[model samples]
Target: MEQLLDYINQHSSSGISEKDFETVKSYFTHKKLRKKQYFLQEGDICRHFGFILKGSMRQYTVDDKGAEHVIQLAIENWWVGDRESYTMSTPSVYNIEAWEDTELLMISRQDVLELFQRCPAFIETVKMMDDRNNIANQRRITSSISASADKRYTDFINCYPNLLERFPQHIIASYLGITKDTLSRIKRQLLQKE
Candidate 1:
């Protein structure tokens, strides 16, 4: 909770005073998920957004052919939930699953709205997060459509070096929209070049 408050304060345009920050912190509740647990599944209505405090989670969609497409990988201090579903009150297409034993600070949509109404700093933090998310999504889209496999892999490393150690190769490949074999070949080719 302190981590989340600190994160909000850091990202916010203004600092939250200790008493106010405590009030802001009160809006969240703690939750945990074991490895392989589902925070959300396809066709479910997403009710709460969570801030990861510890461990990792993967957000993905399963195709009709039973293939999973990794969309987002979230770890500590990151936020998770199907935003569209949570905001619009619709069923989600993605599954948010715990990749490891995970702890989170969960907040309801109503609480978020209340925060936005009550705290200018919280609004700023949300805006900053939205801007960052947009930039990342745009880069991912451009790389997915135009970049070579090697280039994509390199970009993935540059963007999320920490993830390479945390997630499996196959999972990373899925996130990069590449096959496991292609990722292997790229890694091998790069290794040989080095």
Candidate 2:
């Protein structure tokens, strides 16, 4: 809980009061996931939004052809969930899986609603986060549509150097909307250029 508070303090300048933190903490349940475990599966409602205390997670969707499409990755100090399903209480389209042994502080939609009603500052922080996430998604979509595979791979590597090291190339390829074979070819080209 203290660690969560510290993380909030670092990421948000709005300042969560100790009392508010305690109130927020009351709403959260700590959870652990073994590597490869799922936090949420497609066809199930995503009841909680999780804040990662340790380790990494991936959010992905399986296509009709049974291919998994990577949507996002969250590491320590990040948040992961199917926001639409969590907020609307609908079945999720994505699967949220642990990429490593993970610890999360999770809050339900009801708790989040209560927090928003009780804490204007926290609400503001949440709004900021949402805005940033939307912008990022938009940027990724634009890049995918406008950029070449090599350029996209370069942009991804530049943007998330840590993910390049931590995630498998195939998953990264999926996230970039490219095939694994294409990613391998690009990687080889990049290496030759280097």
Candidate 3:
């Protein structure tokens, strides 16, 4: 996809050469999923790493009490997969599901390894994503363990403003580790402040 090429070029130290771009493109396959379809399910091995060409997806886990906890949400231009499972070839504990009819550029684990060796731009993009993901996870962990609910909600809004209208209130609340009622109160308080 052109979008994938642009994304890789943008992330690269020097934009990818046309020769490398063709190699990069060849490694990926286009995939489409309908709303409510799963890209990955718990206990399933993650076989492909996907980049969203259009639409959104959510990665979450369900507890014994049958409560879903949102771990991550991805939209256009975002990458979605169970990294640990993809890397180690283990079963994923989370489910990655499409939130809308979605189109993605997917590469198999074996192909990714081959691409990494062949395309420097693709390698750079993967490295950049890994760094960003680590930083985001660190901040999220700190916030969850120490920050107040309202403060966490505020940070979330600031970090992902566009997601407010994309996901349901309950999903947002779940992601923030807050109750629906608490999220409502927080939203009201925020509006009042504004």
lDDT of each: 0.92, 0.89, 0.94
Count of backbone clashes for each model? 0, 0, 0
Candidate 1 vs candidate 3, lDDT winner: 3
* Global CA lDDT computed for model 3: 0.94
With candidate 1 superimposed using the best TM-score fit, by how many Å does residue 22's alpha carbon deviate from the native? 1.4
lDDT tens string, model 3, 6-27?
8988788898999999898888
Residue by residue across 1-194, what tens digits does model 1's lDDT show?
77987898899767777876777888999999999999999999999999999999999999999999999999998999999999999999999999999999998999999988888888888889889999999999999999998999999898899899889999999999999999999999999999
Candidate 2, poorest ten consecutive residues by summed lDDT: 6-15
Model 3 weakest 10-residue run by lDDT: 4-13
Q: What is the lDDT of residue 116 in candidate 3?
A: 83
Off by over 4 Å in 3: none
Best by lDDT: 3
TM-scores across all candidates?
0.98, 0.93, 0.98
lDDT tens digits by residue: candidate 2, 145-190: 9999999999888888888877998999999999999999999998
- Measured on C-alpha atoms, candidate 2 has an lDDT of 0.89
